[model samples]
Target: MPLTPIDPRLDPGVSAALAAVAEREVDQVFFVACGGSLSIMHPAKFMLDQHSAALPSDVLNAAEFVARAPKRLTKQSLVVLCSMTGTTKETVAATKFAQSAGALTLVLTTDPASPLAEAGDHAIGFEAPYTTGVPIDAKNSNYARIYQLVLGLAKIFDGSDKLGALMDSLEALQPAIDRAHTHFAPLFADYAPRLAKKDVIYTMASGADYGAAYSFAICVLMEMQWINSHAIHANEFFHGPFEVLDENASFVLFKGLDSTRPLTERAETFLHRFGATENILVLDAAELDLSGIDAGLAGNLVPLIFFDTLWRFAYKIADLRDQEMLEARRYMKKLHDY
Candidate 1:
């Protein structure tokens, strides 16, 4: 596969849409997607939660959302639908439902002509920089593309200087990711395949990293590695699910600048209570300087770097093995029942 393609298509498109819609305060934000799109929406949920505390992050599995959560819509209700192809059944339908409710709907997608994109008030499409020709695990360009839109929004809404410093931070951290992958590659050569074949790998993180932890383990690792993984919020880990911990299972966690060390520490103590399963803590070694950026913004970027880097590194490793290679309809068809 070629060097992982970076998506630049949605940069100006999404940035401009957000700039134009800057008038909307977005009283309520609903993130709607199914499968991988929902997974990737994790970062946006985290950022929106932190930046727009006034706007609650409600991630709905599009079908369940329209069925159960339907409410009177105001211009305040902002619905962001993510579907790389712009044809996923759930996303397309939900965008229509959200619109019917009178909520403002936006779409982030790869296909501008897709039915899903057409349903949105604004459609942000990430132009893939390149293509991976391999039949399996071949196309993952959109994941990064949609991610840039989120980071770009960070620049506009959260005041990250319009991706200037975020890009710099990513550039600086890219090397750190390269180094970490080099170190873990060989060690994980055997372990990755082993864990990938297991029944499940549980990823746990509290606060903002929760969505990322879920996305990395369940979405990226499981989807790419062809394994089973699920993410959990840290505080909720003790609600009795820990009883299932065992040697056959694997447990994964993320360590980054804004990560909640104590909750994870508590999880560790609880995991010891069960006495099984291997534990891996992926750390963000990226040393970002916050003196230049706002203190509140610093925490968000640190973990976001880990989120951006870990999935890419995992995909690269999977690429060498030609695994976790689900693409749009062909790939997700097997994974999703709908």
Candidate 2:
């Protein structure tokens, strides 16, 4: 079965809470999460960095945030935390830490009954689909919900009426994503057999698309498929990661319609020079016709477009390799009491 979008409407209370956050004049936003949830906040952080510089932000590892306890985390700080399970010990602890620091804490999770959700000053619990048989759907729905919440925050802070149109643009994103899947699945299927043979891969992206590349590499490939992979930033590619490009290297580059697209293109050029052109798979957001979305908004949506395209390839690769995306865990939640 094909994937469906999560509800685009923000819960009224959630919207009201965020509106109050905006009204309170939040100066710094700290996104605290671990693993994939942490990766999902990158785009939101990027948006703040690129567009709303006045509202500075940081993406903090939940445990690290609790350890360091940044001095700037105060009543004026808005801490956004999320846990898919709502029970990650570090995240739950971080939520308490943030609250204790007088920071406004917002949490997104699937289980309202869990500790993290219950600890938050404002919690929005999403309905996670039962994807026991459709692992991809689970991820897709989770990603979509994150998109709504993150971009909704962006909309509030950006202080532009443009976000009104952006909301509609986002609502239409699922159909565009479905179209991307339909167009790319055959090509991805053909490539998956060969890709599945590789022991390691390098995923690269610039600007907002890096969120998708990072998530796909760590969350899906490393954690799910047990594949060895590295997520590299395009601008940082030449710094040291370029040394790994042998003939057998697999490179996935996500290009987006942003100022940093040229940075990724340069990396792609380097990849072509160092390896076979076919060795580099480029997922460019510009190729996706996000027609009703504003150019700037579309640029921000690069992560979503990239994730939608790349994860489908990953799902295909997992299928060809007979790997269970949900079952093969090395140390994530498998430890007895870690």
Best by TM-score: 2
What does candidate 2's lDDT look like per residue over 55-144, in tens digits? 788998899999998999998899989888888889999999998988999888878788987999887765443323343332235555
Clashing residue pair totals per candidate (backbone < 3 A): 3, 0
At residue 239, give the lDDT of candidate 2. Answer: 98
lDDT of 2: 0.75
Segments in model 2 whose C-alpha atoms lie over 4 Å from true places: 1-10, 127-158
Estimate the TM-score of every prediction. Answer: 0.72, 0.88
Q: Report how far residue 263 has shifted in candidate 2, in Å.
A: 1.0
| Candidate 1 per-residue lDDT over residues 230-299, each given as its tens digit | 8877778778677677666567655444546577768766665564534444353343333444344444
